[model samples]
Target: MLSRAARPALRAGASLQTRAVLPSSANFATLREIEGRLKSIKNIEKITNTMKIVASTKLNRAQRAMQDSRVYGKTSNGVFESAETKPVEAENKKKLVVVCSSDKGLCGGIHSGLSRYIRREALENPNFDLVILGEKAKSQLQRTNAKDIVLSFAGVGKDIPTFADAQAIADQIVLLPNEYSHIEIVYNKFINATSYEPAVVEAFSEEAIAASANFSAFEVDEELLSNLREYALANSLYWALTEGHACEISARRNAMDNASKNAGEMINKYQILFNRTRQAVITGELVEIITGATASEDM
Candidate 1:
């Protein structure tokens, strides 16, 4: 015969055994949900890793183009450096800023950094007109300074920039009716694999170049001044575009790498949770079976 405490404990076990079916089904559903989420995270990781590889490959070519363009740009500007050229100052003249950014995104803060620099310049001196070379910068600056935009280009930064592309853009800038005291080509400077900063390449007006302090040292035909200014503009623009492309590629690689790492961590955590939950469901079913057998024996 069973004691009073033993009788109550046996009755409670029988009740728990009766309700076990629903709990088991619920636990199984939970496991299924965890599995689905884990699969999705894994897929995301694969995509990010692939993007990282592509960006890394493009980075090398972009850096090489940047180095070559830098040599051409420096050689063109050598005369101005020696002469200590400066922008011709006049009360009526406005400065021109050529902003170089890309249409594509997901490369971290490359676009925002250029926009921020433009904003800062607007605050310090509002006497500048913008000639943007990419949709990214044009879209950003339009929201705040639409009226200041003189021209904007599309289809920029699709691949490694070419000298012909720079020459075409410079031709358009030269055709603008409004005269500028000097031109500033703003772009991202590649510092390292993980670092970049906004920088400017100066392009002087024909008048500014002619007014250079030591201009008399070099004798040249008067007609060549216009040609020299245009050539120098193209060279500077080519340099800016190539350097900006490298910076964008490097930033994208780093961003994708970080994303892949985070997804991997989530997958690991979910996998452990899934295993523990499966074991728990199995243990609960065993307990229920044992309890039912004990009750039958008691009866």
Candidate 2:
């Protein structure tokens, strides 16, 4: 009952209706394929989200512990640095390097940062002795073909770190001959919840330790100074473990953030493809019908 002019409008209405209800069968398959991909991305996003939350929680605790440990470490460093203003005793001495890395994996840049820390020290100091704490660090050292390495620790955290763990490492370093004039620590310093940097290579020289024994600094005698020295050494060991833990959580959080973002992007891309493909399918059907009707009219 539609007029000739209205027929074109009717066809347009039909085309729009068809586009809304039924897409091209060819593109239906493509849409389903994209739908499957979207589902995968959704699952990936959920997993990444869970990991990010866990990392966030763990990082908070780690940061608290690191903060608590830093107070003692700062006191040690300040006293030591100030003491350096005094006269020197031992010069041109051997260097001892303590490396702090992780037992578990999945943290971005942490292992690599620690590895390079070792490489830089080994390459720079010929007389340096390495005391690697984690398996990751040990493996990295072997890869660098740095054979002159010592495994100071096996399982740092079978569960979590304790003062005993630090004590064990300190024992090894302390047992080394005093001819190795200085002790240096290489670790990743956690700056914030999402940022970290390769900790400045910190070395404690005998002179610094001696300077810390200044009568002006602490009203203590040689015996007390010796005891305080032992105490400070233990504090240093504990500080490294806490700082390393904090850095690990920060790195894992960052890695998970990237993963979650990538998943969301994939889902968006697939949805766009599905929409465009469905539209193309509707336009194709419309053109086909219009061409057939024009041919019939001409005949």
Give one digit per residue, the lDDT tens place, for model 2 in 53-162.
99888877787788888886787777766664332335565566778886778778788887876677666766666777888888788777365675457776443455
Tens-place lDDT per residue, model 1, 1-299, is 99976896878776765865548888889999999999999999999999999999999999999999999889978989997889999989999999999898888889989999999999999999999988988888999889999999999999999999999999999999999999999999989999999999899998988888887688866699999899999999999999999999999999999999999999999999999999999998888778777776665
Instruction: List, in order, the clash count of every candidate structure.
Output: 0, 0
Candidate 2: list runs displaced more than 4 Å. 1-37, 85-93, 157-160, 176-179, 201-227, 273-299
Q: Which ten residues in a row have the lowest lDDT in candidate 1?
A: 13-22
Residue-level error in angstroms, candidate 2, position 296: 20
**TM agreement with the true structure for every prediction:** 0.88, 0.70
In candidate 1 the C-alpha lDDT for residue 98 amounts to: 96
Q: Candidate 2's C-alpha lDDT?
A: 0.71
lDDT for 226 in candidate 2 is: 49
- CA lDDT of 14 in candidate 2? 60
TM-score: model 2 vs. ground truth: 0.70
